[model samples]
Target chain A: MADNVIIEAPMPGVFYRRPDPEEPVFAEEGDDVDAGDKVALIGVMKSFHDVTVDTDGVVTEFLVDNESEVEAGDALLTVAPS
Target chain B: MFEKVLIANRGEIAIRIIQACRELGVTPVAIYSDTDENAKHVRLADEAYNVGGSVARKSYLDGETIIDTAERADAGAIHPGYGFLAENADFARAVEESECTWVGPPSDIMEQFGEKTQARNLMAETGVPIVPGTTDSIESADAVREFGDEHGFPVAIKAAGGGGGRGMRVVERDDDIDSEFEEARQEAEAYFSNPDVYVERFLDDPKHIEVQVLADEHGNVRHLGERDCSTQRRQQKLIEETPSPALDDEQRAALCETARQGVAEAGYVNAGTVEFLYQDGEYYFIEVNARIQVEHTVSEAVTGIDIVKWQLRIAAGEELDFDQSAVEPRDAAIEFRINAEDPSEGFEPMPGTIESYRPPRGIGIRVDDGVDEGDDIAPFYDSMFGKFVVTGQTREEAIERSKRALDETTIEGVPTTIPFHQQVLGDEQFRRAEHSTTYVEEQLDLE
Candidate 1:
């Protein structure tokens, strides 16, 4: 079986879909990604932490929305193994 | 009584308020910040509303938005559980100005007691012994030194308008007065938005005791004995217990009476706490908490008094049902504040996924928690995950039970104060009741 990947939040924060609202998203559905790739940025009270993909895969669907508040362990994106 | 109450807080307190509402047969409507969508409080409540952003200013502290949500949910009263907007005088006024009732004290009473100096002056008039200090801010280090000489050594310089651990300094000797005074004043300005500082005699090795009092609209007021909260770090209480090990029967009676007299004189109503610092044989009045306290569960555990329900009843214009003598605290109770902090690393807040969490359960152990096993401990809000409250037949039994309870509680994926609590419980000084307010800091060397 292919390694089905799930991107999870590294910390509790507001999940920003893109670096900026007007900018293009870092990862979207069907986007190809490798291990250690940047997936999203999480904004806490005053600091921003980044999330990365753990396994090489093609992004299938975004589990969370842009600027959605999320806790640690919340899924950010789902991916199909390449 | 209110048919529905909106809990304007998050975390353990929200869960606590929700439980209270349920027991009273009132619907509990909980408001959650963006960070708290899956929080335990939200799940436990009758109805949960999304307030706003993860930041407290945009969510929990957004009084207008919260009130709007309350109206939309048709809540009859608002309970601002401790912290967030709990002690905010303006928030209390806003609730009262709205159609709904505020479950704590009246805003006016809050305003009067919010300032430490004002409360000190008010309580002094009622013959409640207060720490010998200047009423106004000491303008300079020279002023602090002069006050210290008159009051004797070890003077405490504190911000006139400060609470928590901010803007406070204990000048052990005359040489340290200038630097400590300046640091305290600067911190006061930075944290509290108030730069004024005052001086007072600092008692060495004092036990922190606070009396829980409740008053109703019908003019009935009573004290619920005293709680010893000497185990603290950075002025934040880590553990609290009822029927202070340090106080004898006479001292307990005297302290309770003094607190009642002080509250009566202040024209206070509703739930409140009169805090005092007891040193040697005398007790000195500290400030008053104008809202339900986090440690109130310990009092309830021993006294069988549901404080939150009474807060609602008192706000609804009902008289307190019990008399002073009618209230007798049985057994001994202890409360451990479980904060998401790395106790090994200077107690820095360690917010992360709970991964696995299991609250201790057994006879006489009650857990008031805000997060589940899979829930994340949000760093955006207060670090307190919950509290472990335990009660037993005697102080020793309570201590033993508390130790077992702490050992049984397992919180993963983040450091917690559990280890510190375990160590404290096992310490010889604590077991022997030889610990003072400075015990934790001195033993840990937090400073």
Candidate 2:
């Protein structure tokens, strides 16, 4: 059984899946990510802050939709340790 | 007239602006965060858009996002009601540079008055009496002590970019000046992003009086009398009333005149407020609030003028229809701020779901609020849920009416400042109008 870890938003802002509109998503479901891998970005006050995953895991699902408003501590995605 | 006007704000003031737009036959557009999805303003507006997250920085303060929303919604104008980006010169300039009209004073005027030292200097140049202090920012604590030595102790070291008593420190003696000055600078930097500070002689037991002024592009400026906001706790106003019982007729006329002249000299347009500290029959200019204030309702009630509607009309290039002589203040009016705080618990914020909410209603009473029963008072924003205003023919009548209205109000699930307001109405000193700015902290013990 895989150990599931929920990734939460570090700050309150609009959660974006990609770095820019023309850029591809940093990670997707079923992709294996290393420790300290960038998973998302939170855009607020005219700036974007990187949201990174700490532990090595496989991205299982995105809990919140792309470009959705999120609060601090709100779950953004779910990851299973590989 | 604008076909659609976007209100870049939330809460009661947003509702107020929406109503004004409706009366003017302009569509109202609302922008909300995640927490304010079900807010009253959102429901009332003709069009609503999601701005950003729950916090102000992500939503209300995001000028680029707000402008983009206005552009997407095809709004012809934007009304920034009071807080958030209302006083931001950059946001004002952005709106100016955009297709949407900015319903506020010119950006240059905002920049001039945004800094306290600059405002003081402008008022001084216009012959408006200012508090004795440095007209420029002090570089070190030694500068503060030197000013104190000349002006006496109990001096106030205030942040140049701060207002509403956020970045102010009062040093009573020589020993505390250095520490207070450093603390004031740090707090100012943290809050206003500006570490520059200026020193002024702190007046003891002074009346907090402010004059409302309206100016148009046609170069006409008029004063809308004054309001006494002396009932304050920790420099936050709890109650405000017009035709202050403390000022005589002669003094009131002079104060209003000075406010008009000072703003006109600065080339200020649209609605603004000039605040003053009055003591011993003398009034000194303090600062200018370049945006519409929360207590503007009090002045509107007494003068029979719709200030919000006028703000829209002024922004649309309308001249002042009425002159200063037409601005007549009739009956006395008082406004009570009903905030989500427990007065008994030292006014700590107690945000929660309002299980039951019933505001007072009847003749000589008006209630302006943003929440309904079963609505959650989010901790992400200001704790003020409503404002109750009462008006009567005389000051005594207004006071009595306020007591009756407060008693009739009901709220559950969260502690309110209603109890504190009740205690104040029943106090003899408050009844006699003997209270000053420090009255709430000194005379009344809520515990």
Candidate 3:
């Protein structure tokens, strides 16, 4: 069985699953991603900050919903290593 | 007046509008996000409805849902208490096209002023002294250079639809103009979804003064004295006071009257603010905040007029019964914005649980806030949680009372801008009222 890693939010803000409101999401569960691949955004204080994954893995689950309020260190997604 | 008014906003301003609605014998209805179900505004309103998710986009900024909620609640009017969708022309038009009344200026007026270039041109034609800048949007870096050459170095490239320093960049040198101009355009595109920009001569040091005006649909307009908002950080106002210490009696009258004339010529209605940049002896028109502002408390304190009530009355087709001579503002008042920010860490946003919350009391103190004790400061919205207003017969007395008011107000858990406000009250330049817009960001040292 492959071990999974959790990606946490660096700061508290509104979690965004896509680049723009009318655009497609960056990635969904069961999608493969590599290190430095943008996965989410934290919208705070009229500024948007990108959240990137650090390791190559497949996103298995999303813990936070899009446009939901999030706190720092909250788990956003679970990625299983190949 | 409306029998039921729906406040399409959250926090302090929403509460303010709710109180105004009650005063007019109207029922106040509130809409809240998932996080604000038990919020103070919700608890105070006559009726509360769930808008959507906690984040503002899914809730507060959703125009379609807001209209639907207003319709379902049987609200006769919708009052957008600043921020969110207050200045959105499209939203205003949708509301106007709906059965409910929009408690603001006409949507056409909002659209005319939304574009900065057109607003400046209108001001010029209306005999308002506009700042020396382009009245048209520039298409390339060459135009910026041309404007800079015609004017001087250190020109400001600003977005046509942006305000509050959102998409503004100042270029100092000849070589840096291109990059700075490009950055301004990109920010303009990203923030406002408009890439058009224009150039203007940046004032090195100037006082930020604004005049409040109230207008009715019947062409009755009146001016409430001036507020000097010189103490700011990164173009964000922290402390605002009425009856500007920088202006004498004659200058105040002229500025106030000019503001009234400018808006009156524009055929504006409802409560709005006319902003200006006052330098040596000249005051230049900047732009208009088409809705009630955060610092409106200072003006209300000095003028003893409920501006919000007038907003409701005007939307109902009421006329101003008093003449210009009958309106007179007395005394001096000050307002300090209390924001959930860590001043020690470059004023970074600190969102957490507020363990304790208390505001001062007595003769001359007023505090407007959205949160109570033990409430959480969510990071999804603006950091400001409240406003502290104090008034006195004289400016000196006002400053003295401000110190006591600041000391009495207490809050724990999340760090606030209280310490910064306290330091400002004690600073010599600030006390003397000699500070300008850039004074706080460039001169004040916070440790």
Candidate 4:
């Protein structure tokens, strides 16, 4: 976990790699992220929101599976500083 | 009523207002934050628009942006559903001055009720029973101590501009008064930007009860009934039910009548709630919520009245069609707030995507939900996602049905208080209606 920053779930909801499964993910492993890059889509009931990167980094690992449920504070992805 | 009304809110309350608009044949325009682009309320509205960023300060709380959104959508009225800018007199005036009908009380009335001391004085002058306390801010510790001594021990030191328990301190004994008073004042300054505090006689083992009232432009005001909201943690109600078991027929009637008189005296029009604390067969006024309440569904279930629609009608200068005797309540109804919070962990907010969600539905069951199965519960907003309202022919039946409904309900991705509510429904004390305001903190073992 050295040199890696984990993007955690801020609330309880379902995580989506993209807006829909057919669409490309906003961010993926090996992709670079600015401070506010859209990372993933999270859904709770009928409401949907874009999860954004908190700091500049490179996506190192996808810690959560696509469409998987994530709780607040749960790790979703790990980002390594470029 | 206006052909279109903008609902400047999100979540179940917004959805509830939209439903009312649809029933009244008024177009509902929903404004969403960046986080609520695909919210249930947005999808359910006749028209929806993106207001601003995810932060409430930039979106829902931005009165100019919201009113502008309403104008762009051709909405002729704005229904601020509780919180955000609901009680903000400035926002109400802004909406009214913009040539848009505000589906609430007049801005002048709101200003009077928005001030704690002024509202208290008004209620007292109208013959409304208020908790024995100060009519003005306490200037010194000696004053607070004197008031406490006069009112007896166990006084509540409260910030003049406070609600939601932020700047309130309950001093149970004489020794704790000085320190608690200072702490309460500091908290008031830090939170509400007002250090002025007041003292009120604290009721021991009181039941949080409120009367649902509706008023129209034709000088008509009537109360639906009483709701017991005693099951609260941290001063926020988790469950609410109409026909408070703590109140007998006489007490209930008197409480409701007093609330009606208080609102009428204030020249308030539209849907509002008069809150009270009932103890030892007596009811004392606490405050008035100037908009629709979260527990309104319970009253609706029992009364079959569309409160939001009446707000629109009243704002449109229509008189209340039904008088006090004509509005009939047929049964008992209860509501449980479904929030994305882990009840086991001190009810800490658990904002995340709801992986799998299905609300229980059947006869006498009504769900006002703001999210679907896959929508994300945003951390930047209130944790509540929806409400489950159930009605039955009797209070016992409603309680039993509530347990069954909770059992059938399933929400994944985050922990909820469903199990806790189930336990509460079956608890002997709760079943017997013996619990008080402190029930959730003192009786229930959340751990």
Candidate 5:
């Protein structure tokens, strides 16, 4: 059985999966990510901040859609630890 | 007239715009964030759409999303009330490019006024008495010293792209100019994305007065008198009143005429304000607010001219039907900005759900608010939830009426600026119109 960990937004802002429209998404469901790996970006107050994964895991599901508004501590994605 | 107009803002200003739209027989479409999904502005609008997140960046400041929402709602025009994107030249251009009417001044004109030095140059060229300051950015401490030598010491180093008391520093002595100048430049870059700084002669006890002006596409401009907004804390206005007790008839006329001439020369259209700093008996031009202001209600009360309605009319290609003489201002009106702040605790924001909210009512009182009973005053936005405007035939009557109205108002669950306002109304210096911009912090005993 895999241990599920929820990735939460650190601040309130628009959650963007990709850094830019022309760029690929930072991380995707079913993709393996290491601790401290960038998963998404939160844009607020005319600037962008990176959201990173906390542990080495496979992204199980993205709880928030791309470019969706998010609040601090809201569950953004689910990850299953390796 | 537009079939539907989108108000790209939230709170009392949004509701204010909706009221204007309804009066003009135009449908009002409101945009809200996740936190403001059930806001009063959303409920009052003819139609409401969710823009994005709870924070302003993802929602209110997201120009692309707001324009897209306007398109989706079939809104022919957009009114950005006060804050957010109200003065954004890029947003105005975007709205224009998107084939929707931008209900403010021309974007190009806004661009010019957005830069402080350029605005000063323009005002000077228009025969308006501007504060003795650099018409361009100062590059070194030498230039600051030269300005000080020319205009005397106590110089103010300000950001060329900033306003509302941000990116400003006062150097009392020539020795402090170098560091203060560098600090001002850095603050300008951080706040306005412009590192340019300019020097000005700092006036120590100046009355903060501003004149409201309205213009249309045609060659018509009118001044709607002036408002004294000296009652402020850290440059944030707390109380404002019209028929500035600081100015006599001659001074008032000169101030208003100078403002109209300056704005007209800039080819500015729609509703705007020309702020000035008055010291001794002379008034010097400061900056132009290129959009409808929070204190427009005070001007509206005295002038009896609906500024929001005119913003819509001007954007719809309507001309100013009335001449300058037609704008007859009467009575004394005061506007108290009621923010959810704890005055005892250094005016820190105290955002919380309103358990019981009851605004003052009856004659001589009008309350423009965004929250209701049980509504949460979200931490994601500005602390101000409402404005209580009181009007009377005289300044004395207006002050007395405001006191009664403030007394009747009731709110629970969060600390408010009500107690502070009550104290201000009772203060002798405030009643005598002797308070300046620094009075709130320097003189007032908050305890």
Candidate 6:
């Protein structure tokens, strides 16, 4: 748990855990994820950008609320080694 | 006509609808997000209600909340302008079931045109030429390849449930089909909540032409001519104009008639736009925008028609009081989208407060904006805050006037698309009408 990494938003916009409103969240807390897996998306200017995980880990916690405005470098989630 | 109408949207379009309602002697009600407490729309509205939080899903996209606001305001009709819930057939259906009338096409027609594949099929059945593509959604890359094999490479995979360039990808070679198709599918799922996609022969270079059609509930359909939206980057239009320089008089008549017939056959009503892609000498029906669009003002300027006013009238069961011949667009017009994006920084969104705002004014310029000086530009919404529509006797005159209008226009504090528009207006190729849909991406430096 000490070796954890926090992912941050690359730009400003609304962040979404689920791909769309009705779809299931890409990953939930305590769920295992691999590198290159998209955990969320940053919605901006009628476009969507995938926020992919950079390392294999278990999602420890989501740091930001879904569909909330997020700025660049804002902490999105915390991940620990699986 | 409605005694009062609720506008279930925000920004310049909301203002546009409010003006229309006022002109028709109807009270205009407005809705706002948490960040839009001081928005221009709220100030201009006879009554304003807060929908929800800053995020669109919590606010403007909340159909039930908007409907509730309409009820609270006692508005007789609801106008969903351009975006958010504008083309949502489910929302329109809900409005139909409610006490308020929906000020657009019927819910069934919206649903019909909302699904891209069904639209293509319907247009084809109605004798309108559709782009060479699948009338059904494709399931895999192999199916797309089959289409590419028959129609050739560089095929466009488009979302079946949405338009306006989202969830669309162009696969240039057979080797890139699998990856591109997957990306398009994922985007389709992300945006439209549906992964269904269809393949089409991607015209390498085509002029984007759309006809403005207004159909009354009584079956009178009139076309307000076509606009050439050729100057675009990444399938997003930057500038649009009517009486396409590329089309001759015969082609223009044929295209307008085609759109009118297509919508008439589909039993469409209210203000809608029929979009097409024109290449060589042929034009193909792409899709229909079942609500008033951003570029509708250009058509309005030339034809001297108040399309939004007509939307209210038609929704109230009034017949179109004019004939197709009487719907003559005398002059050419061009609309420039004033967006809060930096041309220097690759046209990136730079939303902030407008320290000072002054739109151009003169003989042939009309400005539709949602913000004034000192107003904050919300990042959560679309980048476009306003549009500067210019008209003149001919395309050359319109271009000349546009350069002056754009120069006279001034928006302080945030980076804008003005510089990019200014550059395009100066370009010889653009002035002479030689650009296509991919013109901006291939040629201009966005300076």
* Top candidate, metric DockQ: 3
Q: Which stretches of candidate 2 lie over 4 Å from their true place?
A: A1-82, B134-199
Off by over 4 Å in 6: A1-12, A15-43, A47-66, A70-82, B133-201
Across B1-447, the per-residue lDDT of candidate 4 in tens digits comes to: 689999999998898888889888898899998878998898898789988877676798999988888888888999999889999999999999986889898898889888766787899999998889886899887887787778776788888887766778888764666677788889999999999988888887889999999998888998999899999988889999988888878887888899999999888888999998888787888888888889988888888888877888888999988889987788899899988777887776667678999899888799988899998777667888889998999999999888888888889987787877887887888999999999999987665
Error of 3 at B51 (Å): 2.1
lDDT of each residue in B1-447, candidate 6, tens digit only: 789999999999999999998899999999999989999999999899999999888899999999988987889999999889998999999999999999999999999999886898999999999878897899899999889889777888999888876878988764677888898989999999999999988898889999999999788999999999998877678899988999999999999999999999999899899999999798999899999999999999989999999999999999999999998888889999999988787778866789988899999999999998999887789999999999999888999999999898878988889999989999988988999987898876665
Two-chain DockQ for each candidate model:
0.19, 0.06, 0.58, 0.10, 0.09, 0.35
Docking class of 1: incorrect
lDDT string, candidate 3, B36-60, tens digits: 8888899899899999988788899
Better of 1 and 5 by TM-score: 5
Give candidate 4's error at residue B400 in angstroms.
Answer: 0.7
Candidate 6 at B387: error in angstroms?
0.3
TM-score each candidate: 0.79, 0.78, 0.89, 0.80, 0.80, 0.83
**What lDDT does candidate 6 reach at residue B97?**
96
lDDT value, residue B18 of candidate 2: 94
Off by over 4 Å in 4: A1-82, B134-152, B156-199
Go through the candidates in order and give each one's C-alpha lDDT.
0.86, 0.90, 0.90, 0.85, 0.90, 0.90
> Per-residue lDDT tens digits of candidate 5, residues B88-124?
9999999999968999999999999998868988899
Better of 2 and 4 by DockQ: 4
Which window of ten consecutive residues has the lowest lDDT sum in model 1 chain A? A43-52
What would the TM-score be for candidate 1 when compared with the true structure?
0.79
